[model samples]
Target: MPSSKKKSSAKKSATKPLLISAGAVLAAITLGIVSWQATAPAGTGSSGAPAVAGPRTDPAAELKALARRESGDKLAVGRADAPVVLIEYSDFKCGYCGKFARDTEPELVKKYVADGTLRIEWRNFPIFGTESEAAARAAWAAGQQDRFDAFHAAAYAAGSKEKGFAEHRLVELAREAGVPDLERFTADMAGGPAAAALKKDQEEGYRIGVTSTPSFLLNGRPIAGAQPLDTFTAAIARAKAEAAQR
Candidate 1:
């Protein structure tokens, strides 16, 4: 009878383990539901997260701060005096910008900037709010760590998903991009003139009448939206040709 009771106790223990597993699964699902509810973009439900506001029109201190905090001389992937400068004002949350980063820019870098015919300068226009600003700050901080290009590619590689651009996500993206000093990077994100630089980019974009993502300023010529490869090729060629003539 004692042995029978022992066997019964073992059976009960096995059932208890199963119950515990089921509870864990339920708990995970519940947590996921709560997190989803909290993070769902601005208007999914009455209880949805609040809307993310873009930059304000305050005296443009963010831009100035960014410039001051910027450690490098200039963010050119090629020669500064390259015949053509392709200034891209982009938002990380922009699909077209992501496509350009993934599809167009690689070939362009190889053909133009890498070969020294064009200089590519990226400006962050964080029109998407906290997440966007955080992403830009991560990139700037990564740049300080000498991994700007890597971080940029990582940020794009993280995909064009909108709300995933939060600070923690940016840090993860930076990690994927091979940023060595994660702690230092995080600290830099809060420090320096990051806010100012970001603000300035937005103000400058506003001043220049930029109303779209992935806008191109080819030697100061405005090209709205993402155009095909040939359009950029032609523009670069034209700029270089004109420069040569001068």
Candidate 2:
């Protein structure tokens, strides 16, 4: 006959391993859920960031106010009279900003800018540091010679930021972008006009609640990321429809 206490001991041992395995699985599942929630957009998460702003009451008026719409502005593209405007506040050193510039912006230019449906206004909101400020100034300097868009493309080319934007690198980029006068580019980058231009762009961004790089205003509606191409296409379509009714 078996001893009752010994049988009890065997039963407990059999269940102990099962209990440990179940606990581990439960812990792993809980951790996965936490990670998923953490990766959601900051404004939409429990991360304590400010919530995304709701739609504007007077989107068209606010949009018109921010559109600049200057034909001589080298940092802007498309027709000044385009029905939809996309104002981008970005940093030269931000990786995501580069992603949008390289991956998304050209597509927008091709589809909408070429057709006179959209205008893109670039705002120099340099949040990084001295290099960022310098790059912004340099881009503006390039614009003095009518090469701002080219310099912008070179600055945001893949692997460009890893090389850094020292004064010399900026000059090299200007050369690549075909600025007509290297002497003028250097002088303008260090001049007061560059500083003033940067200040104006930065102030505009800050006033409109832009606290991050690559933020955008599409006809006065805020889009806070380098979202998918469809996001932009949809925004442009909606803005165009609304403009037609105005």
Candidate 3:
């Protein structure tokens, strides 16, 4: 009886991370259709529309807790101790995600990330099937070579998503990003680390109730959709002020 109990505990311990990773990936690919409809109302839709900005419902503690603040994270930009962190849950296949990447993200990178006031950590929450997942993995692989931002720009370049993310296409994007080692890029994309990294981001997004692509958490208060620059700017300011108080 003790042996059986030990075996069950060992199994549970071994399976926990796999359960979170694979389960969340499967949910993003499958359950997302239903989950999005159910959970998206708190945030914006896929069209970059804003949710009703009523009184803030998310608690201050939770909002502040979302910042990873990891200096070594290649997928993130800005100082680790940046006063405000914007956690973005996005998919490569999402139109609004592309829109934000193109139009809004650059300005934020310039005004905030450059100044070391706001940190942006990307979450891979692919919801558009195999190709989207592939793109996410490719992006994560690019991060391994310290070219994630460059890869991000190329992947989200005007009309890039329309081209789709075949293995060759992803390789092409990696080249465009100047990833230095094409052979390594290809191998890394299919390797275990990329899958594990993608799974971790996806599970965190799901756990926090993100139901749509381009969903953002500015200090943990959910901002659904690809909101405008002003919306993000205001949220960043509030988060910074709140952080200062602490």
Candidate 4:
């Protein structure tokens, strides 16, 4: 009896760390969802109302480590070794995502990407439904030909989402984005690789509790919604300073 009791105690002790780790993950995800709900834009399908405030605190280290920083990442812009990285998880069908793409992204690219101070990595996080998933795959296919940015722009252009992301529409967008081989683009879009890539991105977003479109992580600091340009600039400045220190 004494030996059995000791073994039971040892087993409980062994499970404690695993339990703690799981709890931490849950807590982080809860915080991320709350933060996003707090700051998400009105009509963005997150809160369905105007944003009240921004993130309450910086994200956990586990969330920050989500940056891929891969040199050959086709869906990313700026130098691979840039001091700061901004990870954007967005749905192509999202209006606010389009707003960010059209209004704010260009400025960011011109200022930060051109200077090599920041890298922007895109993750396909379709939440609307099948069309959103198809659009995401098409974007990934466009990236195969080094045309992700162009495809993104064409897809997010005003009135583009209204046209819907049907197979024909996606192909048309690819043509507009200057994807060289329409045949190859179509094939790749329907291929396993695109699905795998989309799955990886979706899993990452869900793990970090991204319940809305256009959620961002700047050096692991969560910033929800399509906020003003100054919000991003300020965050970038702070992230840059921190990176310089590290």
Best-performing candidate as measured by TM-score: 4
Worst lDDT run of 10 residues, candidate 4, spans 17-26
lDDT of 1 at 12: 88
Candidate 4, residues 150-241, lDDT tens digits: the string is 99999999999999999999999999999999999999999999999999999778856777778888887777778779989999999899
Off by over 4 Å in 2: 1-60
Give per-residue CA lDDT, model 2, range 50-121, as digits (tens).
645753244235444678889999889999999999999889898888989998899999999999999999
Better of 1 and 4 by lDDT: 4
* Candidate 3 TM-score versus the reference: 0.76
lDDT score for candidate 3 against the true structure: 0.81
Candidate 3 stretches with Cα past 4 Å from truth are: 1-60
| Residue 181 of model 4, lDDT score | 99
Better of 2 and 4 by TM-score: 4
125, model 1: CA deviation in Å? 0.2
- The stretch of ten residues in a row with the least summed lDDT in candidate 3 is 17-26
Using Cα atoms with residue i matched to residue i, what is each candidate's TM-score against the true structure?
0.68, 0.76, 0.76, 0.78
Q: How high is the lDDT of residue 102 in model 2?
A: 92
**Residues 1-246, model 1: lDDT tens digits:** 999999988988877521123234334433433454455465543223353364223222222212222225334477766777777788888777887788888899999877889877788887777777888877888877788888878778634455487777888888888989999999988886777767767765655445567776676555656667887898889978988998
- Extract clashing residue pairs from model 3: 44-224, 63-219, 63-220
Which scores higher on lDDT, 1 or 3? 3
**Shift of residue 147 alpha carbon in model 3, Å:** 0.4
Cα lDDT tens digits, model 3, 1-246, are 999999988988977521133234333433433454355566663333675565334333444565778999999999998888888888998888898999999999999999999899998999999999999999999999999999999999989999999999999999999999999999999999999998988876775556677777777566767778998899888888988998
Q: Give the TM-score (vs. native) of candidate 4.
A: 0.78
